[model samples]
Target: MAMLPVYILAGICLSYIILLLSLLYGWRNLKNNPRFVSPFETGFSIIIPFRNEQLHLPGLFDSLKNLKYPKNKFEILLINDSSEDDSEKLVQEFRKMHADLSIELLQNQRESISAKKDAIKVGIDKSRFEYIVTTDADCKVPENWLQGFDNYIESQDSDLIAAPVIFVEVHPEDPLFRKFDLIDFMSLQATTIGSFGLRKPFICNAANLCFKKKAFQVVGGYKQSGNYAGGDDVFLLQKFKEHKRKIDFVRSNNMIVTTSAQKDLRSFIQQRLRWAAKSAGYDDSFARFAALTVFLMNAALIIGLVLCLFDASYLQWLMIAFLIKFNLDFMLIYKAAVFFDRKASMRSYALSSIAYPLFSSGISLTSLFVGFKWKGRGYRK
Candidate 1:
């Protein structure tokens, strides 16, 4: 029993030290914030794929109205993924309401298990510009989002770019969840951006990611891994990383996309499980290593907790383990929060920290089952 706790303790310690070192390495690569979210004179076709987005359209339209870019320079093409709801009608409503901007509704032609990827592919095929940016239909985008992408593209000689996604809700409304969970998420976001700064990044969200049309085609356009119900972002990112280390992490708050929070715990778990399931098939070595380290750290912590229930000696070591985890996580998240301009909701972070490890550990195990329900559809890996 004692040996078990010691083993787990060592794993957490080692992982924390590595994360600390990586965070420092990332801090040095800071550059001027590229304003891709703004309305530059350059033309762009923003691709937003949707199945049922009726509930989110109000917020979406509100954000669309606030975009700082010129209406003539960029257009919106919303892909309707056979939504049973009135998503197409909603788009029509928007078009009628705002006649100044180009807004077109494209029906997604179904081809594979990855419906979202197919929608994006269809959008890519229809885009008019060399720069293709993808965001979710349910997100609230920053006004200057396009300007950041444009500036970054002009400044950097890169093809693939990863942008940050922030949570829009101030409070999750959940009962007594620590702010640490939110903090941890921000830290992970920072680490992702930081890794790009260090020129070894492997994390990105499709909620605000952009790519050059040429590089996306050069990598064969997700055909290699389109079967995955998830990973439209990560698999494509691996291709970018492999082809060139020129992958950039977009850090400007203007380039960020703010997404709504999950409605409840069940939704949160399923969402996280979907993310964890993709870890098994990642192509990037650095990504795999990072995932493995996080897994080991969390898994070990859970094991140590079980051991502590029987062996009293592990109690002190537990405190040390938590302190290391908290301090390191806090440092990374603090930097990221500063960049995102989001103050940490520490109440959620502290409780979320305790729940996050167990939550991640459980989802990692559940992903081995290979099939899950998403949006009332069955997805199999």
Candidate 2:
């Protein structure tokens, strides 16, 4: 019946409105959080996991060398995941050059399918500090990154902290691919911060995540999460949530970790597919509902366009749907852009918006049947 599509469209619009309100509430809560800066007293163990990241290691080491925290209060643990490249040698060389820093190189003891989780566990097992922080080989940390966390933990009494991560334009003259990736990644980061505002935090990037060593041990330390290749951050967050542990999101410019965008479209799509695959493993009903609502909203727009081919009247509804979704999404992403201080990136939002529905729906469908390759390894749902 013609009314079926109308009803579905109504549902989609309502869902977007609910999502928008939730994000708005979350954004306000995030902004209201008083910025706290206290003396650095908590000792931290920073963990970097890698496989064939020889080229990126230099920049990471340079960033690590520039950290403003007291050298005695933190140690760097580089866990090599059996890299075929010179990643191990690079860490060793960097350690020798900075002998004054408490840096150590260790091999990833793989015992399951999730090599990254195994690598992180290995580092956590060897960590000597009270806190554990994880970042990627391709990421660069701010000088005040540790200081921000220290201040936050000291003030909030948090067991886990999720910080922001942004993608930097690799080329001075940005390509369309890079711009698209930036917008998409920003939307995710916005959702992350907003979810915390809503008090239903779900997603967090391991690239800038910190948690207490004792809390991790109490939560069983990724015993069953190793079944998935990804979600070292999100899955663990869920466990902490289940145990009613205290977690907070650190929303500060100095805490943001900058990472490189994928160089090519193939790599970009693969990365997204890997991320999407983790959704199948999410136990959080709110997260699942959010994801489904987003997918259906986008799918309706795509489907509405096709329906307009036969019935021109459907064009009116499609336009209304697009406008509603566009305005809501823009509001949320704009708040995130302000926080990241990359409002100039919004120039690409219009183009990225047009393409996102197709891209997201495609990734969702592909994730159902196709396995994705990450760091020379393949995984399936």
* Candidate lDDT values, in order: 0.77, 0.90
RMSD of 1: 2.4
Predicted structure 2, TM vs. truth? 0.97
The weakest ten consecutive residues by lDDT in model 2 span 29-38
Count clashes in each candidate, considering only residues at least 3 apart in sequence or on different chains. 28, 0
Tell me the TM-score of each prediction against the true structure: 0.92, 0.97
Q: Clashing residue pairs in candidate 2, if any?
A: none
Worst 10 residues of 1 by lDDT: 173-182
Question: Best-fitting candidate, measured by TM-score?
Answer: 2
Model 1, 1-381: lDDT tens digits are 447657757776886688667866786575647334432645678999998889997788889878887777788889988899987788899999999988888989878788899999999898888888888878998888777777777777568778888775355554443243356567668777777777777777998888888788987888888678888998898887777646777666667788866666566666777887777878777777777777777887787788788887887787788778777776777677677766646545666677777877887888988667676687775
**Per-residue lDDT for 1-381 in model 2, tens only?**
287897889898898889878978897888644454668899999999999999899999999999998999999999999899999999889999999999999999989889999999999989999999999999999998988889888888899999999998534386788888998999999999999988999899999999999999999989868888899999999999989999999888878899988878899999999999899888898898889999999999999999999888888889999999999999999988888888988988898899999999999999999999999887877
